[model samples]
Target: MSPFLINLALNFLFGSKGKEVIDLAQRLILAAENAGGSGEEKFRAVMTALSQYAQEHGLLANFPQPLREAIFRLVIEALVFLLSKQGLINTHKRAYYEQPTFPWA
Candidate 1:
């Protein structure tokens, strides 16, 4: 997971684009919190919100479908790590808390 995340960060978040992705992540955290649900639900909400925002803003637009999904998954993992670290949510031991079915493209 760490390697995949590091790779994603390097691939998608270089130069000025890094700041934009960070800002998007911060907004995503707030959105998930406001979603007001159990840990899994809030986490799923983050991915859903991310998908919608990405589609609207053409984020990762040029990437292939598989690569785009991988990037989105890493983004969700990063967000979940943040949420868990801040004590805002707790995930089950299962890998990625059984990743929600969101539109990744």
Candidate 2:
């Protein structure tokens, strides 16, 4: 994702009504970390946690399915970008996201 898109997603996530989304992302990251396998396994763990979270939390329930999915994707991508920048997690996609511009700054 580009910095612009990442910034947009971050704006939404860090906004007033962002707690739920942020919590979901944090939980997913934790799930990935605890997956205990290759990068692919960690990715699967995040997706599995996402499913469970959706069932439990009804995340973005009021939104249409497509919009909700798009939001989820954006949230995950932006978060992974940020965390990887901080040397938190390595999904092997960091090289692609390294840019001179820092969206979270």
Candidate 3:
């Protein structure tokens, strides 16, 4: 749901790093969860991961540009793919797509 942060992280994942960004993000998210944090906490963890990676890659200079949104959106696609691998989101204990079934329909 918080594409903003994920997309930002995605921007840091270009070139050779692109192939491993999802795995890195998943690891950060899982680690955050294992520490008893919520999904929002996981999101923040991945954002921090991306920021740190970008810093290592010297990609931080490009982040302040206004023209980067399109690139960010592109990264969002990969982030979505990574998040999907987590299977069902556990919040509220009900399936996100679950709807009331009409037995007599």
Candidate 4:
């Protein structure tokens, strides 16, 4: 299973109030895959979805900074894992190292 799917499953199984977020991420992942973009583009799409979810749901504001950071980290890691599984990323590199360079960058 891709990391995104795994995280979604685990969140559904163990995370309290994570169903919506997981479902959103899953949908975004599927969309990115179907869009047939480059690996980097697909990864960016997933990250963008996650960022949008966090902002829309006020996850960043509702949770403490540490908790918010942790959650974001988990989601990014899951995305990288999923992308890598799809042969989009080189698994040898650290996922955290590949930061997106947007205006938010």
Best by lDDT: 2
List of clashing residue pairs for candidate 1: none
Which regions of candidate 4 are displaced past 4 Å? 1-18, 62-73, 79-105
Candidate 1 vs candidate 3: the TM-score winner is 1
Write candidate 2's Cα lDDT for 39-61 as tens digits.
Answer: 78987788778867886967667
Q: TM-score, each model? A: 0.51, 0.56, 0.42, 0.46
True-structure Cα RMSD, model 2: 7.6
Tell me the tens digit of each residue's lDDT in model 1 across 1-105: 364674476467685576676677777878787889687787678778887888989888888978987888887776666556545565554345445547494
lDDT of each: 0.71, 0.74, 0.54, 0.67
Q: If both were scored by lDDT, which would come out higher, candidate 2 or candidate 4?
A: 2
Q: Total backbone clashes of model 2? A: 0
Candidate order by lDDT, decreasing, is 2, 1, 4, 3
Candidate 3 C-alpha lDDT tens digits along 1-105:
465665666667574665466566566556556656665665556555555655666774666744444444345445554445444344443343243334477
User: 1-105 in candidate 4: lDDT tens per residue?
Assistant: 666876687677768657665587577767577667687787667667766777887767767867866776687776666566566666565444445535475
> Whole-model lDDT, candidate 3?
0.54
Model 4 Cα displacement at 97 (Å)? Answer: 15
- Which residue pairs clash within candidate 2? none
